[model samples]
Target: MNKKSCLNCGHTISDEFCPHCGQKSDTARITVHSLIKNDILGSIWHVEAKFLHTLKNIVFRPGKTGMDYIAGKRIRYNNFISLLLVLFGFNVLSYHYYEKFAPAQPLTDDVIYVKDFFSKYSKIILFVIIPMLAINAYSLFRRIKLNIAEHFIIGTVSLLGILILFLLSDIVSLIGLWKPVEKIFNIIDKIIFGLSILFPAITYWTAFKNSYSKPGLLWRVSVLYVLMGIETLIITAVLYEIF
Candidate 1:
């Protein structure tokens, strides 16, 4: 390997990462631009950057991306959890702004309450359920050679895909929040609703398929699909009973 000096502790190094201080050998020098751009403003999150590059792969070839990641071919991709948390922060900010423009309505019935609850908090709920979802997936696909943490990686990526869909739908909703296209936005919202549910299962299916192509992969994924449906209904039922 080519040699370099560790910037933090002045140790000699021969790899991208320093073995002594564990810092990147090429850590950017601190400047006002670097400080705000790289760290806070996320200037590196552009489409041509590693984050969007990873997203492009995740959108098109999710399963293969997950497989390659777990197989240790991950030098090019950004951290999945970090990317998700960043996006979730955007999600929260967008909703908070949109909520300011909308009016409050009293919860008249259980159906309305559940629908409103999910309308505001579905992505957050889905994020909370990811660990449980990972457990469900691993239990169903026990034949695959993955531990819970590895299963969590797959689940996180799948949820990332769904979160993107939700944000897109919410953007449409936000536009309709002020515009006069109430009817059209209603249709679009319905479409977004369908896509949000379907895309996650599709993401999980493709990811699992690409990672391992064994017999019964189809049925295992199908079982997971059915379980997710049951889980959603159970949640709705529980919410109905509680509120």
Candidate 2:
């Protein structure tokens, strides 16, 4: 048993926490040794637990994670900004891989391949992602009441899933599975491509149940469909220009 004192009023306390002043009775006189060891260790442990939990939840179940954060069950996860930074970095890298190596055209034997790849794919990635993310943001803004960052994370995770699917296809293509199942995967890919546009919309629906007074789901779906169509047109134009 450790004897402690309240920092305020100089009252002796039996436990680690002070009942009189409501401060930690274990707080010792500020010293270089204790400051570096005890304070830093405690803070680091608290932060580490939250960060790991957040990463785990985000990776395994993104929709639920967004719902949890929006419902004020935070402190079990990392804050939005930290997750965004990490996600953005990985997203950039993933973008490079998808645009470079996974397309119909191989990167080698053509200097123009890199430039053309970016020219064609960049706009699709941008326009589609932006509007979808916008819908996601507004949905959460109206419904579960999370900040912009949270909805963006939901969108990002969904897009990341699509990207992963594409990469998996690319790998299978290289491993001879593409030849055997090329036709089948192509059909599947087309379906996935269409559904990818609806990811953020679904995420919006799941995260925000009935917290907001707004238009019906049909209205929201219709609006998102129109935005997706516009994005599809923009991407088509960009591809045409590049090719």
Best candidate (score: lDDT): 1
Task: Give the Å error, residue 70, model 1.
Answer: 1.5
Candidate 1: segments with Cα more than 4 A from true spot: 1-7, 14-19, 22-48, 102-112, 115-124, 177-189, 210-215, 235-243
**Candidate 1 structure quality by residue, lDDT tens digits, 33-138:** 8788867677555534887788778767766777788899988888998889877877777777767777786666976866777776566467756786788888
The alpha-carbon RMSD values of the candidates against the true structure, listed in the order shown, are 4.5, 7.7
In candidate 1, list every pair of residues with a backbone clash.
63-207
For model 2, what is the alpha-carbon lDDT of residue 94? 55
Measured with C-alpha atoms, the lDDT of residue 163 in candidate 2 is: 47
| Per-residue alpha-carbon lDDT of candidate 2 for residues 38-157, written as tens digits (9 for 90 to 100) | 789868988777776766565456677777766678767766655555555555565566556554654564667656766557646653674466564565356555556656666665
Candidate 1, TM-score vs. the true structure?
0.71
User: For each candidate, how many residue pairs have backbone atoms clashing (under 3 Å)?
Assistant: 1, 0
Which window of 10 residues has the lowest lDDT sum in candidate 1? 39-48
**RMSD value for candidate 2:** 7.7
Q: What do the candidate models score in CA lDDT, each in turn?
A: 0.75, 0.61
